[model samples]
Target chain A: MAEASSPGAPPAGASRGFGRLTIEVRRSVSPQLRIGALAGAIAIGLTISAIALVLAGVPASDLAQEFIVATLFDPTNLKAVFVQAAPLVLVGLSAAMAFRVRFWNLGIEGQMIFGGVGATAVSLAHAGPDSTRLVAMFVAAMLAGAAWAAIPAALKLLMNVNEIISTLLLNYVASDILLHLLYGVWKDQDGFPHSLKYSASELIPDILPGANGGLVIAAAAAALLVVVTARSRAGVYMRFVSASPSVAEALGVPVRPLVFSTVLLSGALAAVAGFVVASSQEGRLTQSFYQGYGVSGVLIGFLARNNPFAAAIVGVLMATLVIAGQNLQVFYGIPQSMVQLIQAVIVMCVAASDFLTVHRLHWAR
Target chain B: MSLPTKAVALAAASAVAWSSVALTASALADVFKIDGPPKVAIILFGPKNDGGWSQAFEEARPELEKIIGAKIPVVEKVPEDSSAITPPAERFIQRGYNVIIGTAFGYSDTFKKLSEEHPKVAFLDASGITNGPNLESFYGRTYESQYLCGMAAAAASKTGKLGFVAANPLPVVNWTINAYEMGAKAINPDATLTVVFTGAWNDPVKERAATTALIDQGADVIGQHVDTPTPQIVAQERGVYGTGHHRDLAEFAPKATQCSSVWTWAKFLGPTLESIKAGTWAPSPYGAFPGIKQGGTDIACCGSAVSEDNKKKILAARQDIIDGKNAIFVGPLADRDGKERIAAGATLSDADLWKMDWFIPGVISQK
Candidate 1:
């Protein structure tokens, strides 16, 4: 539905760029077109990454093997991808949940650290029976994460302090606390800067012979999130809040409580990620385990448009890229920085495509 | 379970474990043997050209290749996390590589687990703490070379005040600090060595700030035990002298670097790899601690500032250390608090060196 003042000529109110071109905000986009645009964006990203890798001296065949065959067809490599993806999926969901309510939640790493510390504390204390130890650790991790997250959320709500600054700064405080424990009280018998390894009972069990339980837990969380965000009454309220906070409040939605609860839930999810990494990947509370995941979580949420299922897919895709990056470095001696550069290029390309969904370019006479 | 109950149970389990261990003592000393021709692959914790610790290993790669007569490929910037370490290491093993070299203390646990899972593969880690029959963790007696660098720093200083930038108060780092102080005092009796811990291995910003602060406090020469050459670069910028660590800082600050305590990993690893190939490799139970004589670490000494006489003196001291005539941590050592550390006529043991937490006289630092 073009609004033109004159039939064969440009309107007086037309944008003056090139005296003929105009950008029109789309009132609605068909689901098919939206999917097509997203698919095209992802395709462009992959093509760009593939070309960059080839130019970086990775043979095209090897690139395919590393990116697809090794990661997907090979069972062990696939397991490794899932092992990495589980934590990423939780972190992505954590970021997505808070971001949907207009909160940055940059303190995901900090919350994760607190979660790990809390789990380690439970193990060290031997707080429950063997059957209930894991449950206790999980609950403690979520609570710790929520408590850490509460600081920035409260500051934003009560004192009107910027959440971005508070959340980002709290990461440093959490890091110092982690180091203090690792270097001082919680150090292992070997005097290393890491907590003691957890007992067998403290570790996340394998769901099957070779399948990691953390992956199952993460998938369940994602599925639950899909249901909650799509079907629940709170989900409807959340959508209203996201659309327009003032309007939603005027229409009787409890905006503050919704935002506060969402942020706390986000923190709890991130903490679960930390617990998964510690229990499933590292096998102990270790320094530097939480590194780089915050950025990955935010990026995954953005790419998925804060949709839980899409975030899960993007998280796995990200894990695949990480494994492939390691392979490129191991096989071709490409520096990690180059791999990071390729990833940045792909993310930028996909992000630029978001513009296509929001507006349409019109050719005016 | 309750805490006390858990502790009692743990103690009982350990006592039983120890008796079983004693019963199986004969099996404990079994020598590790490689099954076939050795294929070496290295994992670096930082970039290959990181200018310090990681670069030291990368520079040694060519020498190792020549010794093994095979290419030694490396994966750089691998994090300390097991998830990051395991895939590349497993891939290397899958590809038929038998020998894996890890270059971080953080790699200790993963390397230990990998060594157990693949008993035929030999694993060697630098600055690591875990060792098994098929795994050996090794570190240099860095204090030996740092002592020599100290002499050079003292010789170069206009005033008798020296400052050191260190990573942490870990025993290995502390030993270097004490040795540097001893070496400086040997050159200038009244030299007071002040230390500032950056609490980081490779933060150049912190290193620069610490260097400037020390220089402002009348330290004419600066020494560093941190990973970067930032201290040396800052010394050059501020028109002062500094000693280096990991690699030759003269590469970065040619004019200001009086001496550098550099890792000679190739000199140490070449023979170790040869022994592994020859099936005579017996990894130490307590990890390898090679000194300058065994080529773990040595110094690049004497910038233009050091007088010829001082250079000769430093070289003679180096020769004495190599000949086992001069042990830096030998008896009559005392902490700055007037407390005796090493009693007279007795040398500091390797275990004691590793647990060293107190400073010798002339060394100052924060609590």
Candidate 2:
């Protein structure tokens, strides 16, 4: 195991200002165990998934082929998976940011939906000869997403409300709003409960020939988050607050404001995911558009242990499973729901591995 | 031998023959009946109100119940995943449902396995390929109706180019596209058809995108095999003619969409259920020919967009099909590679039509 610091010298932060506290914190984790723990967890998770597939009646040969095909081989199928994963990656980062500070913002899905509705409303309202109206719609989507998230943030900061419950409950409210738009105001005049077709002027120009621009936005956000958390003073403060709220307060960190900002930022990022999905993927609001990306994002964040960069990778992997599962269905007649079972297994394995990494195991037998 | 002894022997032999016949008849009539009303279970892959395949099956449930005088229990929005299908089916079978209907193609394998395990339960699968002593598969001849829609499109088109937006390029989908092309060519020999596969069953955006691309490519008349109204909406927006599949969609684009191939599943379900009740349910692998004559596959009420002349032509084409004067997959056919599928002037057999997997001459595959 890698030592916490050189034996002859005091911990770097200890001499600088924090004293013994920095040394104690540095000594807790060994570098060698981190990689091993992650690998072991993943292996266990895959084994569980394989067993579930067997119980589900999928032949072992077919399951193996599905995993291989999902990881590689088919680009069109792979593209669909990436498209599915893109939203989750963004929302997962949002959850990770708040989670690092021990703040639970379960309302990421609601924020995303509101953002989508906001963008759709703006696009529909101002659709015409002017191109600038499209830009306005994008801005409106982001603002609405942030505003929707801010409500819970305000509630948590002022009234000391449990954000987890409030945010989770808001998901239904946001979904109801979406239904209202589809069924009432923006409903297609054809009598079907779908929104009217979005005009060409309403769509955002694709960043790549075939890719959605929103994917680029998500990537940029992930990169920015990594840099901020790794190099900025605010990140250190957030870590301090997360580790010990009392110590953070004694060190003069504005705990309440910091919490409020993190929650708000988290919501805004999640909202962007929703906005992109609505504006680019479906164009018009339909009840089936969300496809559970919000919940999947939370799962990915948990698997990544609240690391934004890691969440992105896990999100992509999750999406790959979906695409691969569908392909397997087409090729081997396997059910696509196998993807969900695989996801559950991976999450459990990762969680268990993390536990083992943190604690020493004893053999009783 | 004594006369009294001989008469006794004759009477005993007569009794044995009569009893044998009676036993065989009773064995043939053997049916598993439970106390109270007959329980029927319906499993669906999506919501009952999806306005698609599942919805169509759900609509027939009430009519079926009314016919049988029994309350039917439907399991709606069931996952297509095999893992979910088996457990739910086992539970339903344990509860003693006499009949189970699976309404999706993916459920065929699971239903087949379960049917074997519970031989007393009659299994009816829609859009699946399974047939056993207790399991039967049912599908309507949807391609025949799609051909009529094609005639309407060919007559209504101003550009002489027709478009088909398909969910996937499977053999089932190929039947509809081929029928449309054949019908269009019968009406207007110069007509050209273009088909695009969106690689999904229920993505509205992809469907719309494919429709728009087809319209931009100078396709003046459009038809779609998707489960949503997006195609009709797109056709209406582009001011072109359109046709629908699986259900009536004229209401979605009354101005641009004129007709649809509506499925009437109740036509077969009512008779099939009666047969089951009478203890005469036998596995019949023979496919049902649901043409206009049977009221199973119907051309929905045409919208005002269809002209009287076009309607007359469509009706004439339909009559020809009904009278067996026209065969959609009639041979003398050549695939795209110019290799003869059937020798020139040779008609295709029923087996040939059922297993068709190639594109005809003049059609381009986007693979």
Best of the candidates, TM-score: 1
lDDT for each residue of candidate 2 in B234-309, tens digit (9 for 90 to 100)? 9999998899877788767878887888878787777778878776776565434455666567677466766798
Candidate 2: share of reference interface contacts reproduced: 0.00
lDDT of 1: 0.89
Q: Please, what are the lDDT tens digits per residue for candidate 1 over residues A27-71?
A: 888768777887788788878888988998888887777777876
Listed in order, the DockQ scores are: 0.58, 0.02
Worst 10 residues of 2 chain B by lDDT: B28-37
The digit string of per-residue lDDT tens for model 2 on A1-365 reads: 12333355433334334334222223345747866888788788778888877887778887666676544554444445556666878988988988887788788888888777877887677654467766776677778888888888888889988988888898878887777676567866644345665677675566875455766777888999998888998888888888998899999998888888888788778877876676666556655556566677778788888888888887777766655554444334334456556767787877877766665432211
Q: List iRMS (one decimal) for every candidate.
A: 1.2, 14.2
Every prediction: chain A TM-score: 0.92, 0.83
Q: Can you list the residue pairs that collide in candidate 1?
A: none
What are the lDDT figures for the candidates, one per model? 0.89, 0.72
